[model samples]
Target: MTHFKSQVFLILNELPSGECIGYGELAKQAGFPGYARQVGHLMKNLPKDSKLPWHRVVNSQRKISFAENTDAYWQQRHKLESEGWIIVGNKLTLNEFDQKEER
Candidate 1:
């Protein structure tokens, strides 16, 4: 993998189960502070069967980045809720489960 991708993957791997961070935060932790869009792209391109916890990453608004009614959107919500996260609509309850950039 490329250096940036490797770094992003490392950040993703380090997220504790049931905790979630924003895409921009993930990019910052991966050493690309302004590359939130790139982080989204990387998550989008991850292998469907990959074991990475991609669902733990959300948008800056603490909402699911995916559009509503889509399969991916529901899937992410399901994965997160299954892990004890309380997501109402697309917005995650950040105050309760916010695991911000704590590097």
Candidate 2:
């Protein structure tokens, strides 16, 4: 995989349970400022069996990037809930559980 995508997944895997990093934030953390779209691309292309905590990544508004009521969004919410995250009003408050460890 490309270095940036690898870095993105590494950062994701480091997040503590119940925490999250938004797409924009992750892109910036991966050293590509203002590259939220790139982060989305990376997530879309990640292998299905990869161990990355892909569900912990969301949009800047703290909402699941996928459309509400869709299978993808429900799955995302389910995965986050499985990890102990709370979803309220389309927002997942994860600041308290953030783990900014480097890859």
Candidate 3:
């Protein structure tokens, strides 16, 4: 894997179950502060059977990035909610689950 991808994976691996970070924050933690899109790309390409908690990453708005009603969208929401996250409509209140990014 490339260094950048490796960094992204490392960050994903470190996220505690039920916790989440934004795409931009993941990029920043991966040493690419302005590369949020790259982080999203890396996430999209993760292997289908991969154990990484890709669902734990959201948009900067603290919302699921996937389109509602799609399988991916529901899957992410289900995984997160199963882990104690509160989803109101398409947005998750990050603070309720202690998953909000520290400022």
Candidate 4:
């Protein structure tokens, strides 16, 4: 895998549960600003059975990118909700579900 993609996966794999992020935020965290589309592309191409937390990612607008009512859309929604996320008016803010770590 390319270095950038590898970095993205590493960051993604370590994402804390109950935390959501945006595509742009994911790209920026991976040290590639303005590469939100690339992050989205990676998400789309992930293996069907991949264990990556792709459901934790949303759009820059704090909204799910999937078409409303589509299977993909519902699937993403279900996953997020199952993780204790409450989609308010179809919007989910990054870090909305974050909890303070017990350092």
Candidate 5:
């Protein structure tokens, strides 16, 4: 695997349950600050059964990247909700769900 992919994978693997990072944040944490779009693309292509918590990664706006009410959107919503996420109106509704806040 490329160094970028390796770093990203390591970060993802270590990501705690119910926690999330934005795509740009993930790229920056992986040491590739401007590669947010690339990180999203790479995540899009991950295997359907992959164990990576891709759903835990949100957009910079801290919302589900998928369109509202689509299958992908609902799927991601379900996964996140199961993790105690409180999303409403396409937004990660509660302060607790905000990744920027101190937990």
Candidate 6:
């Protein structure tokens, strides 16, 4: 794994269940500001069966990155919802449900 990928994974694991971090925020925290797409690329390479908290990351708009009907997106949604997150319309607002202590 790349340094940035490991950093992003750490950030995701730190999130409390039911909460999420935006791709932009993750990239910044991983020392790659303005590189959310790079963050996404990192996520895309995560081992499918890995125990890392992949569901804890999302787009800055607080929306899941993939379509709902697709297995990947549905699995993400299911995992988040199981942890008490609610998907409202096309957005998954972490502002109201984040588990991390605000920095």
Regions of candidate 4 where Cα sits further than 4 Å from its true position: 93-103
Clashes of each: 0, 0, 0, 0, 0, 0
Candidates ranked, most accurate by TM-score first: 3, 1, 5, 4, 6, 2
After aligning candidate 4 to the native by TM-score, how far in Å is the CA of 24 from where it should be? 0.9
Relative to the true structure, candidate 2 reaches a TM of 0.80
User: Model 2 misses residue 19 by how many Å?
Assistant: 0.7
How high is the lDDT of residue 76 in model 3?
96
Local accuracy of candidate 3 as per-residue lDDT tens digits, 1-103: 8899999999899899878899999999989899999999888888899999999999988899899979999999999998888999878875453654453
Give per-model TM-scores: 0.88, 0.80, 0.90, 0.86, 0.88, 0.82
Q: In candidate 3, residue 39 scores what lDDT?
A: 92
Runs in model 1 lying further than 4 Å from the true structure:
94-103
Write model 2 residue lDDT over 1-103, tens digit each, in one string: 7888778888888987777788899999988889899999888877888787788888878888887878878988999878866788667754324434331
Which residue runs of candidate 6 sit more than 4 Å off their true CA positions? 94-103
Show where candidate 5 strays beyond 4 Å: 95-103
lDDT of 6 at 24: 94
Local accuracy of candidate 1 as per-residue lDDT tens digits, 9-73: 99899899878888899889888899999999999999989999999999988899888979999
Candidate 3: count the clashes.
0
Better by TM-score, candidate 3 or 1: 3
In model 2, the runs with Cα more than 4 Å from the true position are: 93-103
Note the Cα lDDT for every prediction shown: 0.88, 0.81, 0.89, 0.85, 0.88, 0.80
Error of 6 at 26 (Å): 0.4
Question: Which 10 residues in a row give candidate 6 its minimum summed lDDT?
Answer: 94-103
Model 1 lDDT, full chain set: 0.88
- Each candidate's root-mean-square deviation in Å? 4.2, 5.3, 3.3, 3.5, 2.9, 3.7
Given candidate 5, what's the lDDT at residue 65?
Answer: 91
Q: List the residue pairs that clash in candidate 3.
A: none
Which candidate number maximizes lDDT? Answer: 3
Q: Record all residue pairs in model 6 with backbone atoms less than 3 Å apart, i.e. clashing.
A: none
**What tens-digit string does per-residue lDDT give for candidate 4 at 13-100?**
9998887788988899999999999999999999999999998888867788988878988899889888877787678743333433
